[model samples]
Target: MSRRVLITGGASGLGLALANAFLGRGDQVLIGDLAETRPDSLPDGADYISLDVRSQQDWDAALAHVRETWGALDVLVNNAGVATGGRIDVEAISDWERVLDINLLGVVRGCQTFTPLLKEQRSGHIVNTASLAGLVHGPGMSSYNAAKAGVVALSETLGFELAPWDIHVSVICPAFFRTNLHESLQGKDIAMEATAVKLITKAQMTADEVAATVLKGIDGHKRVILTDRLGRQAYWTKRLVRPAYNHFATKAGAKLARKTRDA
Candidate 1:
């Protein structure tokens, strides 16, 4: 059966990749983004809508447009998010607020607005894009980690609640992937220390690969999707050696602090 899919932040990155993946599978894909220009090379039949996931009005308008076109929604992918990089103490409060508003509350708003439509349909899936940082704290990106962690927790809770209604929820926790994230770093009030920058530069995965994993998780009704081998290892290690992981994080933080002080 062909699924009607709506993806927030679908103009680029993992969201765009997922849109293409679903479109290739013959699903009716609708992409919602704040971008003024749609991607030049989207799938032939894909639909694009302007949306700000943080706004309920935008969600309503997008859902209305989708219903008018597709009649019903089978999947909602809350993929719109922002990233911030800096120590917890040094980052501005506004940075924390902004990241949470988009990364965490955006999912909340999407669910609140679109869930009723899914319930009316009696079957659907909700995929929230979290991060590996949600699973384990890193030296920098405190705001991003907090927002993503909240997303993970929110998705898990919704999974249980929505089970009775046959609405599956899955959270994607990808470590890192090659995307326009660096370009999107503007207006964020956080800057990574040198050591923290080195740590983030080591991840190896592409947005398409991560999107493939996301689709697999959706098909399998997985509770969580880890995009790569390293992500899986980190997830298990975080579970098995949580105290040790905390100690390691502390040590890394100390090292980063030293570097910052020296600079």
Candidate 2:
């Protein structure tokens, strides 16, 4: 059966990749984005809607469109978020507010608005995009870390609550993949992003590859999905040896700081 899939932040990056993946599978895919979409970026035959994840009115409108058009939603991908980098003390309060509002609260809003529809149907899957940063806290990513960690926690509790309704929840924890997440960075954040790109380009999975993994995880009913080897390593390292993981993270932070200074 062809599923009805809605993806947030679907104009570009991982969201686009995921939308393409579902479209290729013959599912009816709808993209929800704050800005007008780039037609060239998305695959053909995909639908779109204006969605500002921060607003409840936008969420309601998006869902109403889906309900009116398709009658039900089979999958909801809460994949919209931004990356903000700076030392905890240096990052402005505005940065914190924006990051938390979009990354954490955005997911919260999506789940709250869409879960009811899924519950009524008694069948649906919700995939929330988090990050490896959520599992392994690093320096200079205080805001992103807090927002993603909140997403992880929220998804977990949501999974427990929705289990009875057969509305499955999956939290995706992925390592660095080429995406527009870096485009949001500014000032020293740009340097940090550049350093990350240089270090992880070889090892990073493309957004399309991660999208494939997401579908496979959903098909297999995985509760927690890690998109790449690095993400899995980070999760296990933190779980098995916290002290060693923290030591390595601290060194990596120092290296990034030096690189930022030199840049």
Candidate 3:
């Protein structure tokens, strides 16, 4: 059966990849992005909606559109987020507010806005895009980690809270991959930006690969989806090998400190 799916941040990167993946499966895909004009790169059959995730007005408009156009929604992917990294002291409060507003509260707003419809229908899936940093919590990434961690926590709670209504929730934790996510990057340290770009560009996985994993996870109704080998390894290492994981984190912190100093 063809399902109605809406993906935020679908103008590019992992969200766009996921949109294409759903379209490939014959799903009716709606791309909700902040772009005023529809992106020319949008795949042939997918529809577009201008949305700013942090705004209640935008979400309300999107909800109205979905109800009018699709009648019912099968899947909602809250993938709109900004990339950020910086030491707590150096990172401005405004940046913290920005990351939290867009990355964490954006997902919250989506859920709050759409839950009524999903509950009424008694079946739906919510996929939230978190990050490995949400779980691993590396140093010099306090704001990003906090925002993504909130997403992870929110997804887990919703998985249980929405279970009675048959609404499934899945949080995606992916390590760096080749994507335009860096375009939204924010930080006080120039070194952090450069490092993020290098890691993203050098990663073995692509957005399409992550999207494939996400599709499988959503289909299987998995609660927590780790999309890369490194992400999975780090998650388990933190859970099973606390001492080793701590050592690795501190070592990475030292390396980052050295890089920052040099820069």
Score each candidate by Cα lDDT: 0.84, 0.86, 0.93
What is model 1's C-alpha RMSD?
2.0
**lDDT preference between candidates 2 and 3, better one:** 3
Give the TM-score (vs. native) of candidate 2: 0.92
Candidate 1 lDDT score relative to the true structure? 0.84
- Which residue runs of candidate 2 sit more than 4 Å off their true CA positions? 36-38, 187-203, 256-263
Native-vs-model 3 lDDT? 0.93
TM-score of each: 0.93, 0.92, 0.98
lDDT, candidate 2, residue 69?
Answer: 99
Clash totals for all models, in order? Answer: 0, 0, 0
Q: Which lDDT tens digits does candidate 2 get at residues 123-197?
A: 999999998888888877788888999999998998899999999999999888877676666534556556555
**Model 1 / residue 231 / CA error / Å:** 1.5
What 10-residue stretch in candidate 2 is worst by lDDT? 187-196
Stretches of candidate 1 off by over 4 Å are: 187-202
Model 2 CA lDDT for position 260: 64
Query: Which ranking of candidates, highest TM-score first?
Result: 3, 1, 2
